[model samples]
Target: MKLKHILIGVGVLLALILVLKFTGVIGGEKTEKVTVEAAGNKKVVETVTASGKIQPETEVKLSSEVSGEVTELLVKEGDVVKKGQLLCKVRPDILQSGYERAVASYNSQKATVASTQQQLIQNQANFANASATYKRNVELYNKKVISASEFDAAKAAYLTAQANLASAKENVTGAKFGLEQSGANVKEAGANLARTTIYSPVDGVVSKLSIELGDRILGTSQMAGTEIMRISNLSSMEVNVDVNENDINRVNVGDSATIEVDAFADKKFKGIVTEIASSSTSVGTASTSVDQVTNFSVKVRILADSYSSVKGGAKDLPSPFRPGLSATVDIESESLTSLAVPIQAIFTGDKEKSPSQAATATNDQSQDKQKAKLNDKNIKQYVYLFDSKASTVKKAEVTTGIQDDQYIIVKTGLKAGQEIVSGPYSAIQNKLKDGLKVEKTTKDKLFSADGKN
Candidate 1:
């Protein structure tokens, strides 16, 4: 009789629990929990990021101007060099023969000029003697001392001597011209031979070497020759990165940056923006055509203090960084202290309609016109404005300035100390409408000054 009474009591308890659950008692509705914090003044910094290679501030490529077999290579890679130092030499067998030929030709032409000059003097003496004889003969012929034929012979002889003198003067001028031409040829031959002996044009370290002794190379006079080596000023280093066209406009000369080199691992170097390209790079390429990536070349110089502690080259050269090392740069464009909120709180939504949505349902505007209109007033930025008394959230449009990693500066449409939904990103993004109810938990940790969760 006691066991039957216990079974009846258990059935009655289950029925009462089911009744409460089905009615408005338990598990009735769900409310999303979100972290809320008041908007406050904080520092906001805007930065642009790009990846590139580290290179020297000044790197000179050495090429052979005359094609020949490298006979002597005095320097090796990583060797510190001085200005006007002999670096290498090429086999000058054919070049030396050509140079000797040019010198011989020049000497021959000079001797010819000297001989022609002596001939001119001799011709002048002959002309003077013939004139003296002709003058006497003319007087004698007028006095009938000699026949007209004799006077004619003397006159012909004098005229011939004068013509010979004039011809000798012309020969001397031609010979002088030939001498100048030969001189120029000699200089050209010397230059060709000099090119076989390479010399350093600047004081730097040989950062690269492409050839060794007895290597045949091709060179050119009209264009750059074979790149035999490179000399770089390693004390000064810079990172060359390609920035997207979208962010290039924000980067300017003298902007501060932080550089992260892959080889350094965990260490960041300070840098400054030294150059920003005005025009776009790599236009109409296959990759760009497919992906529509437009980039501009930017250069950032690494400050000396950042890498001063790093070891130098074997020769005590100030060269800790190597060319073509992968590096990333973050250029700080702007920083300011202003009223801001958590970056998660800022989001984009459908732009506000000018009239009513129903009124614009049948609007007939061209696609281009509609696109122009949309771009004129770009995507509206908004923050969820929390109404404390009603326990509801409303979207408030805001003009955003710059943003750091964690916080975004709100230019207008919100005031300091105003409560806003700062967390539960999904709820703020998709679920929270103008009149949607929310349980605002005042979690100051969400928007801490250190930006910790």
Candidate 2:
């Protein structure tokens, strides 16, 4: 009977222990633990990231000015050339024939001009002789020495000569005009012939060559000509990146940038913002929505002096970087020194009222107004301040200014050295509320240990 009593007592003790464990009577209520940080003054640098390709600052694409088959290709890709260097030659047979015809026409016009001038001189001489003869005849008629019919015939002869002279002068003017027209035609033909022989207009490297021997190209006079090749001055380079519309306003000419190319994995190039587009480029169109993504093109000129000194002192790099290499740029848009906290610490909702309070106070208009005032979207940015004495957190509404990769600038509502809950994102974003019991812990302790909180 005593053994049975002892077994009963042990069983009762075990039941009591299980009840206390399940009901939290022995360990007490568990408080949600969170990492906290002290808001302090620090420099917050704002940057905009963009991807683009490397291109020569001075690049010229060459195209055919006259349509013809490329008969002679003198330069290939990667060949360095100087101004006026012969790059290629197109088949000049057709152009030569047209030029010869123009020359013949011009010569013919010149001969016609000469003939008209000679005829004009002869007509002037005839007019002078007729005038002298008419004057003599008029004087003789006035002296009653010549017959009336003869005087009238002399007057008619002089009028005919004057008319002929006028006609000859007009013919000379027309012939001269025709000669000028033919001369212009000849010049045009000559220009066309010259166009068949392509010459480098600037000193550059032949970065791209699209035409081989015997390839036909179109002329630009009629349409956009076939792009035969590209010549680029590789000594100067630039990166063309597209900036999103939201960040474009902060970017300006002369802003400093850091450029990284895919080819040079370990090196970073320095650049400056050289150009910004005035208009936005549409990246995509949504069929069912009014929202569209737009980007503005920005040009960053690589500083040669700065680029020469890479991370390891510019060793093992190509003499001139090739075009079309993938690159990324980070533009330093703004910087400020202000009281700040980790970006994760700032939450959007009101931390002053718990959900239960909000639900219970719905019938009270004054409480509703207070909730509405706190829930206003315009001033919703806030952080949780840890009340050390009460061991609770209170929502402190804040005005934020700028942010860097990890931290944000607090423009108002928070002071330097004030301790605030930093993370365990869920606790601050969803669970924790005003007057909630909490325990302070470091992020490392909360995340590294498996059973701490």
Candidate 3:
């Protein structure tokens, strides 16, 4: 009977413990723990990132000037060439025939000019003889030694000779003009023939070759001709990146940048901003319903000397750098030393009352005030300050300035060494409120004045 009574007592004690655990008698409630940080002054350096392709600083797109079949391809891709070196040759038969025709026309006009000059000289001699004959006849007619018809015939002959001389002189002038016109045509034909042979315009490597022997090319005089190849100075390189419109304002010429090429995975090249676009460029298709993103083209020139020695020693990199390689650039935009706080700490809301003020209000009144504040459109920027004495948070309105990667400059409304809630983004943004009780578990890792953690 004594052992049975001890068993009942143990069972009752176990039931009592279970009831206390379920009811709020054992543990009151769970307090939400938060991370807090003290506001201070720090240096913030902002940077912009963009992706682009590697290209030669000076690149020339070679195209044909005269349309013809390529008869000879003298140089292949990767061949080093000097200025005026023959790169390719087109069939010159057609251009040669045209040149020959022009030369023939020019020669014909020259002969005509010579013949007309000779004719003019002969006409002048005849006019002189006819004038002498006419003078002799006029004297004879006066002296009655010659008949009237003979004198009249001599005068007519003189006038006809003069007219013939004038005509011949005009013929000479016309022939000379014709000769000049034909000479111009010959020179034009010769130029066209010269176009059949392509020569390198600059001393550089043949970076690209698009045509093979027997391929036809279009003439640039008529339209944009077929691009046969490209010549680029690989000694100097650049990256062409498109920056979004919003970020372009901070980018300027002469800014320092770090470039990472996809091919050179372990290496980073130093660069400087060389150019920025003034006009915006649209990237997507034109649509009325959807908004298109606008970007500005920026050019960054690679500083080869800066990357020659990596990590205090010359790196023996394999393979040569080539055009069209993908790259990313991080351009340092701005750096500032100012009073700042963690970016997450700043929120947008009206002034929040303290825990004591909130506790004094009725439940319905507090709910109505919260609803009104939520509906209010005139919300201001604020940060939550941890009041250690009350173990609660109060909202402080703040004026802000520029921001960096992890922090923002707080212009006003908060002082240095003041502790504020910094993390658990959800609580700072929505869950945590003014006068809400919170347990401060630990302090956040503070960044140095240089913004380094």
lDDT of each: 0.84, 0.84, 0.81
Instruction: Give the residue spans of candidate 1 off by over 4 A.
Output: 1-25, 283-292, 310-317, 350-377, 388-391, 441-453
Model 1: ten consecutive residues of lowest lDDT: 366-375
How many residue pairs clash in each candidate at the backbone level? 0, 0, 0
Write out the backbone clash pairs for model 3: none
Model 3 Cα RMSD, 1 decimal: 8.7
- For model 3, residues 27-81, the per-residue Cα lDDT tens digits are 6554556788899999977778899998888889999888889999999888878
1-453: candidate 2 lDDT, tens digit per residue: 999999999999999998998887776777888988889998988888999998888889988888888889999888889999999998899889999999999999999999999999999999999999999999999999999999999999999999999999999999999999999999999999999988999998888899889888888687779999999888888999999887899998999999988888888878999999887766343442347667899999988987665544223223446788899999988889879887768877544345455444422443334333432448678889998888899988898877766788888899888899987665675678788989888877887763553
Off by over 4 Å in 2: 1-27, 283-289, 311-320, 350-379, 450-453
lDDT of 1 at 165: 99
Which scores higher on TM-score, 1 or 3?
Answer: 1
List the pairs of residues colliding in candidate 2. none
Worst 10 residues of 2 by lDDT: 311-320
Cα RMSD to native, each candidate? 7.5, 7.0, 8.7
Cα lDDT over the full model 3: 0.81
Candidate 1 lDDT, tens digit per residue, 1-453? 999999999999999999988983676655556788899999887889899999999999999989999989999998999999999998999999999999999999999999999999999999999999999999999999999999999999999999999999999999999999999999999999999999999999898999988899989999998889999998899999999876787898999999998988868899999998777788545555657678999999999998877654333567578788999999999989999998767767753333344234432332223323322336677888888898888889888777766688888999999998987554555566788777766456433622552
